[model samples]
Target: MELLSFGDTGWGDELFKATFMTILVALVAFFFGFLISIFIVPLKLSNKKLLNYLGNTYTTIFRGVPELLVIYLLFFGGSSAVMFVAKIFGYKEFIEINAFLTGSISIGLISGAYTTEVLRGAIESINKGQFEGAKSLGLKKTTYYVFVIAPQVLRLSIPNLSNVWQLTLKDTALISVTGLVEIMRQSYIASGVTRNPLLFYSFAAFLYLILTTISLKYFNQLEKKYNHQP
Candidate 1:
């Protein structure tokens, strides 16, 4: 209890703030990653062979690579890559990306890779007859997807997206390597300073469990709500 107290003598405040950072990182990454999946899924499903191949290559590469390595590359080498692009445009200066942006982009890219497949599979699972019916009703393309397809796609994909969310939440721990003060990083510092590894580590575990519990319950509610659609 003393170790979990919220004051200077305890590591509680730091850990609590770090947990918030972890959640924030995961939330932003999830949103951006899902948006990325929107584009990538269509690219993979595109009639053009080039777009299809590019999408396939993106998913293949990101999914094949380790997430940690992706983080390292983004944090360590991203500036150099940006500088190279600047030179091509007749600019000369060092470029730097902060840890927060680096972590978000790296994790989002990784999540986007897996999400592409999930969204594509969900859309494909919907019956062709549904689309045909929408078309026969003279629904515009936007209206067709918005009213008829998007809801079902989201309904079918929520389970997989939840799994992906869990994976992303845990992956934020890897962001600590880039010097972001997330849950695992805070726990590491607290344990080292207090010489109470067991206590701090356990606290970290409890926090993670809380995060997952809330996420699962929320997704389950969504599942139930979507399931009852007319």
Candidate 2:
């Protein structure tokens, strides 16, 4: 209780706030990654040689690179990239990409590459017969994908997607270097100021455990909801 005091001297409130930022970053990365992965997976599955090569190249570069290197690259280079685009649009000044944006985009890019592979496998596992049947019923391609393929792919990919979510959550800790002020960063600040690394680090670990447990329960519920349908 003493260690968790809310007074100015204690760091409990700051740590809690930092944890929220960590969750926010993780959620942003996961959602954006999932969204981008849709196109990547389809491209990879296409017969077009160029699209297939493009998808393969994206996955190879992201996955082959070290995560820390990716983070550093984005942290420094993201703002420059944004500024270049801004200039092309006739903007005079630089378009600054904040640390949060840098962190989220970097993680999202990396996670999306992995997610593309997972989603491609799930989409492939679905029988080709179903698509043929949908066509025979006079269903439009878009409608068939939305009503039939999308649901099945999401269901099949949940387990692997859950793993990616966990990885993203852990990876958010690395964004502290970009000055995101997340859980790990806050813990470091507290420990350095208070000289109680063990205590602060233990608190950070417990918070992460709580996050993982809640995420597991939520994913389990989602799995059950999608499992049986009349």
Q: Among these predicted structures, which one has the highest TM-score? A: 2
lDDT of 2 at 63: 84
lDDT of 2 by residue, 1-230 (tens): 56667778788889889989999999999999999898898889999999999999999998899878999998888888888888888987867788899999989998998899899999899999989999999999889998989989999888888888988998899999988899999989888988889998899999999998899889888888888754
Clashing pairs in 2: none
In order of appearance, the predictions have TM-scores of: 0.93, 0.94
RMSD score of candidate 1 (Å): 1.7
- lDDT by candidate, in order shown: 0.91, 0.89
Backbone clashes for every candidate come to 0, 0
| TM-score for candidate 2 | 0.94
lDDT of 1 by residue, 78-197 (tens): 988888999999889777878889999999999999999999999999999999999999999889988999888989999899999999998998998988889989998889988999
